[model samples]
Target chain A: MSESFQRSAGRKVMSRSSAKELGAVSHLLVDAQQRQIAAVVIGRGKKAQLVEWAQLSGFGPDAVMVVDEGALQPPADDRERAAAEGRLELVGKRALSERGNELGKLDDVTFDADTGALEDLLIGDRRVHAGSLLGSGSYAAVLDESQEPSP
Target chain B: MRLLMTASQIRGLPVVTVQGGEDVAEVRDVIYSPEAGRLVGVTLNKRGFLAGRSREVLPAEAIHAVGQHAVMVLDESSLAAPEDAPDDVAHPAMERNVLGDDVLTEGGASLGKVADLVLLVGSSGEVVGYQIDKAGGGRGYIPLPAQLSVSGVALVVPNITEEFVQDDLVGLGAAVDEFRARLGLP
Candidate 1:
């Protein structure tokens, strides 16, 4: 089979299962060693949740097939755990440069989804090094307000 | 699986046939956008290491061709050297929190200054590491633990020791090798 077909088939098998019954799949946690799909984070209503990678019987193209959600131990807090897992996606984010020094955070990153390549990093509301003057400091600081914290 | 040309192919091209002007300088390096996997600009080593001293940023449109030996430029005169560049700083300085001031190492030594924080991704595109910079000097890649905390401008590392640095934790290659060895990947 073609590579794209194999990928689509895998996604289909995972999606066939009921996300609500087995637990909702927030994201697919990959096992880097095996270079395969590792686990699935399942949410329980608004309170409890569990990570069901080890207990997975199989995975489909869209969802992971698991035996029991009750068999898995739930994390400490639901929302917090979910957010923590979500943050895993931000690894390798490029830090922005300013005045030859790193000044602020790259708030967001846009990439080509199809090729999984990076496009640009949004460096918001941070100081940038423009140039230098005489004896004063040798660097000018400029701020970009677009990097402000989200409300 | 193999459709696009590799960076090495572009780099290996000769400089003679690609026409422009006299031998102003050789193509020193190519800056690629990792996100797009596209060549964005080229760094000309006109004056060798001094190239960094008076660098130039050529737009993608400036490229004329990627033949066997050379990367042809549209106009050689368009290549203007950069001025007023900052001194090279180390890599560790870049990891400071966005709101926090410059960070001093554990020994209170000023390790250059922070210029940026690099997020490391695995081959599968999962964020696996965080790299700190001391300006242009050196970069330290800190592997992401199961949990992370970022408050103000300070980022606290858990369970990371100086030994981690001794494990040949240098570039992306070294970092990935160390991580694989730690995970017992064969």
Candidate 2:
């Protein structure tokens, strides 16, 4: 099932080694091309760390399970990646069809927290599968014309 | 089954306790959990306009019903201060206000500031579209998508959103329906 990025934020990140809650999830670093979470960014700014998706065990309703807190590293190349990719962050971008139809702006994304796979786009206040994505960048997320909304 | 309600519609509804029918607070903000795919709780407002913020959050589990006139509560005591224990940190600051956030294109075209959030109501609540209050004296709704981004300054939308402006709320609602219809979902 898909869940919102908003809901996923603030869930505790639990370290199995100490069985202690390390910190809360702050935001996610989603790979736009890979369409999966690249890393989990947790805690406050500057002191924030990145737990690569591979190191995560599971996300319970209460906590995000990780085998080792060491798996989390200070975020590296986030700015480089953003700069290189033109920063294709998905939560607030406008969506359009290449054929010239104005669809809507993206409000939120629903992804499987377990698999880190993006599932649906809550675009234009509606639910469209990720399959509708044609192309995306920092400025706009183009969609398949068939996915365009109309009366 | 799906339920239809807007943030504006529920914003001021009275929240009363089920046991004695005592009024506690008014609905300030609806808190939704995407993980649970449901409306989890509401943030309450103090009785008067100039009152201070109440940290008390009403869990959706304690919500008796969301009625037309008022929001019924199971227990007023169930409305407790949000758990601020270090481990269970659900930050109050994490709550987003899309309203007034700038709407721009990847190409850097300014559409407008967000006037409202169009919520897609289900077992889980969704922020589906951003009702853009255009700078050019028009209005529109930008559908939410999987591939969007937010930041401290502005809400980045797909390019060329200004072209989709509708004149009024009714037009925006119709546009939202069209958006849903295209997706073949309820």
Candidate 3:
């Protein structure tokens, strides 16, 4: 089943070994080239922690389950650090066609809960296929111009 | 049909990079080369909620397309410092300003004065026509001739131009192709 990134935000992360809450989801780290979720960010800024997609044992409606506290780690690199800071958050960023026309702000992103593979990007009333996403940054998210969804 | 927009309307548009979709700057001024009948570059301003000028400029060669919402480039590296920008972009020539120049025919009959330039949308800064404040009243648009006899004071065009004066941009878009066809311009 597909899950929305917007809906997944704020869900608690629990450790299977300790059975204690580590933190809540702040946002998701996206791998633009692969069109998949790379990690789940917990908290923000200096307090931010990341749970890699590989570390998650289960992604449920109530909370995310990880092996233990060892699964929680600080941002691994500059890209992860930016994602932790919410600089690379996909939601709320303007969506632009490769030709430079504004489609709208990205409202939500649907991804396969089991695989972390992206499904669709919701822009206003339209649903653009994930394969159309070229890249994203601090300013806007670029999608293939020819992939514009019909109104 | 191709969409058309005036150069003045393009001011303040964000310069977005296609790779990361980052808006590096906003257009402060469109640098037009009157002799070449082409847009050479644009002076930029910092892009954000707060307004401020940027030191970088984007040359036309680096532009992928000029759309209604944004000016697209391949990436941030396409932007250059003022010193690296073309001479016309770095130091715009005052005499090259086409706005307010009289529009005259080969027969010396006055049509109007240039008010703004009409550009083809989705093109890499292609100027298609001129928006003029007609000699009699209101505004009109005229398709740009293949060759211009431009002077600081006046722009002399073919006498046939008088027949192609469009009342608005929508009409101008159609007129451009017809006019070009009539003049045998590709």
TM-score (0 to 1) for chain B of model 3: 0.96
Q: Report the candidate with higher TM-score, 1 versus 2.
A: 2
lDDT of 2 by residue, B35-127 (tens): 333455778886656565677777666666564345655445757677732212234335344567788887988888877655543212355
lDDT of 1 by residue, B35-120 (tens): 22234455555543444322554444455444323444434554544442211111112332232223334444433332332322
Each model's Cα RMSD: 25.2, 21.6, 2.6
Worst 10 residues of 3 chain B by lDDT: B32-41
- Where model 3 places Cα greater than 4 Å from the true spot, the runs are A75-82, A147-151
* Candidates 1 and 3, the one with greater lDDT: 3
Query: What is the C-alpha lDDT profile of model 1 across A27-82, one tens digit per residue?
Result: 44332222233344454335434444556655444554555545455556533354
For every model in order, the TM-score on chain A comes to 0.35, 0.77, 0.95
Best by DockQ: 3
TM-scores, each model vs. reference = 0.23, 0.40, 0.89
Please write out the lDDT profile of model 3 over residues B1-186, one tens digit for every residue.
558899988899998888776788899989887777779888899977767988888889998888778898988899998798888888888898899999999999999999998888878888888999999989999988756878889998888899999999989887888888888889
Local distance difference test, candidate 2: 0.62
- Clash pairs for candidate 3: none
lDDT of each: 0.35, 0.62, 0.87
Model 2: chain B TM-score vs. truth?
0.61
lDDT per residue for candidate 2 within A33-147, as digits (tens), equals 5667667777645676778888988866778888887887775774424422324456676665533334677888788977988788888668888777655544455555477
